[model samples]
Target: MTGTVLVTYGTTNGSTARIAETIEDVLRKAGLTTEVLAARAVASVEPYDAVVVGGGLYAGRWQKDARRFVRRHSRALAERPVWFFSSGPLDASASERDIPPVPAVRRAMTRLGVREHITFGGCLEDGARGRMAGMILRSGKGGDFRDFAAIEAWAAHVADELGRA
Candidate 1:
């Protein structure tokens, strides 16, 4: 609780990374030590007292890097307080209602005894990768749907929980 927190995320077009950075900012502002990193860049979770893992959802699954990160750090993560978040759904659905984790993420959470998981609205802008992204953009569905207020509130909650720990 008084130790460092790792806020790592996997993102393709950088939307999820922004979300993770926002989380890190709130955690740091709460007087907690926090580091934000790309999930593929984190080498270990052992140095942190808690971890927050996030990813951009694609096809009902977390991005490959996030999935691999969880798989690689399962043991260490299971020993520490861990939270998961997903950033996808290029609509206001996430803000309008509680969007549950994708099936794979739910299973991972159960297996790791993860404390909580949240799904935030995603972002898709002009330069997003993948042909599907272009298609979605062409179809007029691509836009920034992330809710910063909700994100900050969630981060504050995490900080509160950690303070209690």
Candidate 2:
């Protein structure tokens, strides 16, 4: 059951894909087989022992393709180990305006038997589609906000947990 881990994600400007890659690297370092793919391209979940799926968040919603991926594979996903992550927080600081998980993501978590849902900070590069969004976020000093150490630690923890499987 712990033989292979699928790290899949959907992204608008590519932050979620980067996060998935980081996770894949950590899982591989922990000795678990791992593969990274875009959510839209994933037609099946049956080949993998475990899965980690995430997507870019915009306007309080996950990317459409990632949501569809979950809906399409929810049944197959329910049969395996799973975790979910959302990569789109602009600020390191938490606030009341910060969005919560969308209903679809919540439902997918339950239906897919997901172990956890982690929300990570995302990047807002100049000239990226998020420039307008960055202005809306009012997040000071637009730059990559992703915490690689935290991501690596979480992925390592996932690897440890799956090692027990």
Candidate 3:
């Protein structure tokens, strides 16, 4: 079951990148070889057996780079185990209702028949560039909302799925 997994992410202020690295660690610990790279840095998906794509959310949408990554490799990704995650919904308050996936993401998932999609809370830095964007967005107050336990649990589930495959 051991094989290469690519954990690619698009982050606005680095929260999603951190989440991607955590997933990479989980896969490695499960005896799978993993490479965590920025979504924009991934020129090809041919090197990996499975793909984990992640990104931060802004205005109810995933980062552009993440969307582009999926669009560019949708066919190849459909032939492999693929997981999608979004870093958003700052806290529990924001999670009370189900957030709809962006139109592009929804369409991509249907077209690619992606394996799974998860949404995790995002972190925002006070002085970071994303913070400025958030201010303009009129989103929630800034703070780290990423739940490591939830992230780890999701990663474990992905590993189990890959193992079964």
Q: Can you write out model 1's per-residue Cα lDDT over 44-74, one digit (the tens) per residue? A: 9999999999999998899999999999999
True-structure lDDT of candidate 3: 0.84
Tell me the deviation in Å of residue 26 in model 3.
0.7
Candidates sorted by lDDT, descending order? Answer: 1, 3, 2
Candidate 1 achieves a global lDDT of: 0.96
Instruction: List clash counts for every candidate, in order.
Output: 0, 0, 0
lDDT of each: 0.96, 0.83, 0.84
TM-score of each: 0.99, 0.88, 0.90
Per-residue accuracy of model 3 over 1-165 as CA lDDT, tens digit each: 667999999887788999999999998888788999999999899989999999789888898889889888888999988888888777764345445566777787788888878888888766558546668446657788788888898899998888887
Candidate 2 residues lying further than 4 Å off, grouped into runs, are 94-100, 130-141
What lDDT score goes with residue 4 in model 3?
90
Any residue pairs clashing in model 3, and if so which? Answer: none
Q: List all candidate RMSDs to the true structure.
A: 0.5, 3.0, 2.2
Runs in model 3 deviating more than 4 A are: 93-100, 130-140
